[model samples]
Target: MALPFLPAEHIPSMFDELDEHGDNDRLDAVMAYVFSIWINRSVFSMECWSIFMKGVRTKNECE
Candidate 1:
């Protein structure tokens, strides 16, 4: 499956929030949030694909 795409709006702010020391707490929080969402979507997509494939196989077996 393809990787999950994050929302475009979050991209700019994440870059803007970064500092030379890379010590921005808010950026870390935002990144964590976005990462969690991406992970969830990827897993959900895989599960859906598995279900669809299972249905296809069952239908083919019955034919």
Candidate 2:
């Protein structure tokens, strides 16, 4: 079955970006930056959704 709550292909790329620095702490910090920015914003757009989905995919794969 497709991975629960996520499609597989996107997951790898998302995690790949997060892991590119080869440090989990750096990855977490970058992720927190992205999410904190999104959360502090009010309106949602397709562009925002795409960016948010990157975080979602990474979060799911990490789980």
Candidate 3:
């Protein structure tokens, strides 16, 4: 099975971003920030889901 979010190219970028910080504390901070953004954009708003669904619909239409 394949992953849902993020393309394979983005995975390396994400790991690089995580590695940019010096220590575990800094890495945790970065991850926390990212998690907060994810929660706010994905869980806190219906608009995000609506937009994602639209994208899926468009892809399906193309197919």
Candidate 4:
């Protein structure tokens, strides 16, 4: 399955908001937000791959 990509325009504002908040606050918020999203997506993708591979193995075993 293909992952939906974020648009380029959306990226600048996230960075801009981070910049406006200054170094400390921005760093904390950015790290928290980015890592949260990253972890969630990583888990989701892993689950998807696990299911897909299981399906493939089941099909192969039947064949």
Candidate 5:
């Protein structure tokens, strides 16, 4: 699959934002951040979001 269109410079900022959340609500914070991206970018649909989240869950499970 093609990588998402985020620019290189935006990555650190995103991580910095994520870092603000406490560990207890980290997953919720991440989902909110992802939803923000979907809303701002307007290229990804809810279907894509759902699939991406499922992948995240699977990855976490494997670890």
Candidate 6:
């Protein structure tokens, strides 16, 4: 499916930005300071948060 606001060309830039910081493990911390490429960032906020949450989720169940 196509992204709601971002163009295909900008996707690479996103990955590049993420990669610049380090590995996927640091994505959550990096995401907190990210804001670009997408024209309507607010619309993508949930998606970003979703990615961050998924990466940080632990095997232990929530108590």
lDDT by residue (tens digit), candidate 3, 33-56: 754664334454433322322355
Q: Per-residue lDDT tens digits of candidate 5, residues 1-26?
A: 11233443454456456556636676
**For candidate 6, lDDT tens digit of each residue in 1-63?**
133234444554665565577757567555544535342365655345333223335776562
Clashes of each: 0, 0, 0, 0, 0, 0
- Winner by lDDT between candidate 5 and candidate 1: 5
Candidate 3 off by > 4 Å: 1-23, 43-63
Cα distance off (Å), candidate 4, residue 13: 28
Candidate with maximal lDDT? 5
Report the lDDT tens digits of candidate 4 across residue range 1-63: 121233333443554465566659757776567546643454554333333223344546666
Q: Model 2 over residues 1-63: C-alpha lDDT tens digits?
A: 121224433544554464465557766786566545533355643243444235454546666
The superposed Cα distance between candidate 3 and the true structure at residue 5, in angstroms, equals 8.1
RMSD of each: 12.3, 12.5, 9.3, 11.6, 12.3, 12.7
TM-score of every model versus the real structure:
0.29, 0.31, 0.30, 0.27, 0.28, 0.26
Off by over 4 Å in 2: 1-23, 43-63
Model 3: colliding residue pairs: none
Q: Give the runs in model 6 whose Cα sits over 4 Å from its true position.
A: 1-5, 23-63
Residue 49 error for model 6, in Å? Answer: 19
- Candidate 1 residue-pair clash tally: 0
CA lDDT scores, all candidates in order? 0.44, 0.46, 0.47, 0.46, 0.49, 0.47
Cα RMSD (Å) between model 1 and the true structure? 12.3
TM-score of 6: 0.26
lDDT of 2 at 21: 56
Q: List where candidate 5 sits over 4 angstroms from the true fold.
A: 1-5, 25-63
